[model samples]
Target: MRFSVPLAALLGAGLSEAQYLISEMSFGYAGRISSADNPGVIPNFVVSGQPTKPEILSSKVILTPVAPGNARGAIWSEQPLKHPNFIVDVDFRASGPDRAGGNFNIWLANHGKDIGAKSVYSAGRFEGLVLVVDSHGGQGGMLRGFLNDGSVDYSQHHSVDQLAFGHCQYSYRNLGRPSQIKMRQTSTSFRVQIDGKTCFETDRVSLPTGYDVGVTASTPDNPDSFEIFKLVVMSDTSSHDASSNSGDNNNNNNNNNNNNNNNNGNSNNGNSNGGSNMLYKKQSSSGDESFVDLADEEADVFQTSKSQFQDLHNRLQGTNHQLSSVYRSVSRHHQMDEQRHNEIKDLLAALQSKVELLDEISSFRQRIVALENEVRNMNNELHKKLQDNERSVQGALRVHHNSLTQRVAESVPGHGKLIAVIIGTQVILVVGYVLYKRRRANSPKKYL
Candidate 1:
């Protein structure tokens, strides 16, 4: 029996290859996932409560307590999952100074947009799955899974019986080494592995659509710390076994043609109906048959070559896209650096102007000091001149008083009563003679 397979079917089979990368986040880059704005890039995480905002430190996302009290925080991805069958791989390190005891949760929840303070603790009713690595309250290194059906509300306390669907224990904390956690989920099964060891698996799994992934951490009294080195999400494509089946069928058809040719009698027909037609010919008595099936082989080779080329093209395109994203990020950083440099230049210019003003102020102060000293010297000289003038006037007054006293003493020096009377008579006679001479002089002047 001969079989015919459609070329469209073969091509369709080749097109349905499996395994696609969705998103990858390596905190080593300068742009933070929590602050990314590009749609292709991871968006900034929204943090609630007093937990420290996720920070990129030492090329890792460091999640620590913002304060020393009962500090708890949650950070959720802003983007929703694109596929139902997906895998999440994370590289992380957990450590503390004292005994390692804290709770770390990884949530794939439908309420990503509504994630708030209670999301981490399973406080309110939530719909999705939670994978917990708990090392608190003597339950050290406990790994567990919880599924919320959205029918029942979560209690105030997350009891194991109330919250957990399945659980296992592993020594994850204080290992002094980094650990990798991987989770794969499909329509029928969900599995979790820690450091390449299977921690939990369940066949009865159901996750809702439009789920978002997140991480939350809390510590009571210990100084617990969590650092995420890398995080990636990948999507699984539909099965690609159709291409293999088609190839096998083609091989079987070729084998059948060979067998039929061996059984036939000798043939010699030179008629050609293009390369796609199979030709069979028989001779009279040679008992030999000839067959040509070139088109089938050529078609298989061409299909394979086309598929390879398509795959290579896809990989190159992905690589180019990644390179372009990196280039944009680097360019943005460069522009920011240039802006900072300009601002620093302006600041330096401002400081220089202030220094010049200070210098001018200092010169003015020196001149003022010189003027004050000159005024002080003038005041001292004026005071000294006033003192000298007062002394000269006092000396002149004393000399005048001394001269008058000497004259009075000399005039009264020789006689007592007799000298006084003789002086009086001489004075009286001189007065009379002076009066008579004045009277005669007056009378002669009148006659004249």
Candidate 2:
């Protein structure tokens, strides 16, 4: 038991915190054995039987061997299971050539109870629940569930058939591979899955805490190999003890004290109205076949309200599940949004670099425009200075000509003819200078 607690502690320490469960169950185990002859010790487990002890092999536990009649054996947890949310995965095999009479069972009953080949391969009457895989009818195996509160013995009355809550047909015999049975229970529901498919589920059933989990097999006549390959238990919580175990302890002690309580007691007439709780599925014969909810109570006024309450509770649980899914989706979207934002930041950095390059080009074009304006201003100033120089030279030549004419008139008699020749030469020079200026102005000006 201490070893089992540490295994749960190890699981909790290595994993992140669970949302629903804070404390883990203390009754988890993995099956193991060292050899065929030697019955190896598995932690948190005990083996008990009526005939010889069951053989514990390295890979499987043989509850019943071939050709064994009136043989019975059971392997069960050593401690009470206190955790409410748990999963049990059982890998088992039934190898019988034909209809060899035998049955296998798993139980959650009072602590320290010795379970043997009894009712449905378990005790015919128990204080808790029994799940059965019956192969004794010579047909495909039938998986059934039952409940009792320490009363009504099906073994004595042979009334297990009438008392069954629900069952489904499963051909588990002669399968080459191990058939897997997964029982998953949460706070609001209990579901059974066989061979990776859901077999049955109930949201109204509530199993009390502090009960032991067990596996047993029986052979009334004929031979069969009912072997358990593995038993695995898991929970979604940290390892912690149940706080209200005192109440469970009292109940377990009472059941132990009354060990001789005849499972055949006829006080409730094959049913318990007070302490024993049995589940019944709605049948087509009953108009209220829709009423598949189970309690110890028979169809009466008290059961109606209880069933209604359970239905409301189931609805609330559904709403909670939907909310959890939405939350997970939102978290994923948030992560994606952050990734996209980072990508956009990088893209913006690249665009910013290109904008800076374009700004540099614009600056270069502005400088070229300023240089062109300066060249145009220089060409205009040069043209104005050339015009002024030409005007001054013309004025000096005219003044010189007038002075020469006056001297010639005073010194010689032919002044009139000399003046006329000089006037004609001046007119020809002015005409040639004006034509050259017009030609230069008409040509295109080359900027420096």
Candidate 3:
């Protein structure tokens, strides 16, 4: 719950002395209120509005409205503001059913528990400042600042109509995300920030003392509500007068300690001085006291200077040794870096060779694909030529067969009669030749 301010930020802003922690409240210390609990009986927080007690679930102070109608509720801190200049950090969640009509307020008011009716808007006569989270109408989720001068009668109605002093829009209702608001208030200035962004700031505002810091919310005819996780109020301790006083106290303490050490050193010196005085008294009887005193003072000065020189020499030798060690370490690191660089270079060369080999393989594959395409084109041409030649030969064979059949039919009027005549002629020729051959054979028997 405690927040720390950055030292650098303070110094850079010339506010090095302005950093201090005043108060922090996590709301976690409060006990959980169950259904059986009474709202009016809760300690440290004054709850008003609705019939049910505001529940503190999971360490969060929840202000949920009662169901069935417009409802409002508020929880006010029992402790009053202790510092006029302070910062307030609040971690809260404001959500409900989508587009719910409601708003949440963080009030720094002179009035304690009865600031208003606690329904959808503030009620009752009040003084001091109010930071309103209005999540309704066209300007939904608007963050507005209101200062009640006790002139307007809040009891007449619950609307914060003409009471707004300044306004800024911020989307927090039903956002399903937690929102943070930081307010830094000084004697002459008032500032408000939402989620680290400055939403409103002005110098025309002032808040009196004895004001209570509290939270309130109102839901109108819906399940709209808000919960506060943590609230921290830090008092600014950087006032000029406080810083001067603190500095003076520190200086006084330092002076006192130094005086004590000086007194101890002077006591030791007194012993030496007493010894010198005894020597002086002895030398005075011999008329040599003044010269002895001068010589003793010179010796003491020389001894002090010698001791300082020796210390300086020892420090220089240590520095030289440290430097030598650092140089050796740096050289070793450099050698290691060189070796790694060489290894990386060799790896890069290997990767380059692999890339070149892949490129060559890709080119060879492309050549093979081209050659295959060429062979396919040649094969297709040869097949087309073979088919043309086969068709021509078939046509020629058919013509020749037809011509021979026509010639035979024309030369022999009837194929069967021609065949029989041809057969009879061949038989007569064969018989005549045989008869002649037999006569010759008989006549040839008389002649050798």
Candidate 3, 114-220: lDDT as tens digits: 67435324456677777877764475668888777777666576565666777777778666777998889887798999999989899988777668878787777
| Residue 206 in model 2: lDDT | 77
TM-score of each: 0.44, 0.47, 0.47
lDDT of 1 by residue, 344-443 (tens): 5655565556667777888999999999999999999999999999999999999999999998998885657788899999999999999999888888
lDDT (C-alpha, whole model) for all candidates: 0.60, 0.64, 0.63
Of candidate 3, the 10-residue stretch with the lowest lDDT total is 280-289
Against the true structure, what is every candidate's RMSD?
25.1, 30.9, 23.4
**Which candidate, 1 or 3, would have the higher TM-score against the true structure?**
3
**Using alpha carbons, what is the TM-score of model 1?**
0.44
Worst 10 residues of 2 by lDDT: 280-289
Clashes of each: 8, 2, 3
- Model 1: clashing residue pairs? 34-44, 265-288, 266-282, 266-283, 266-288, 267-281, 267-282, 267-283
Instruction: Sort by TM-score, best first.
Output: 2, 3, 1
- The deviation in Å at residue 336 for candidate 3 is 51
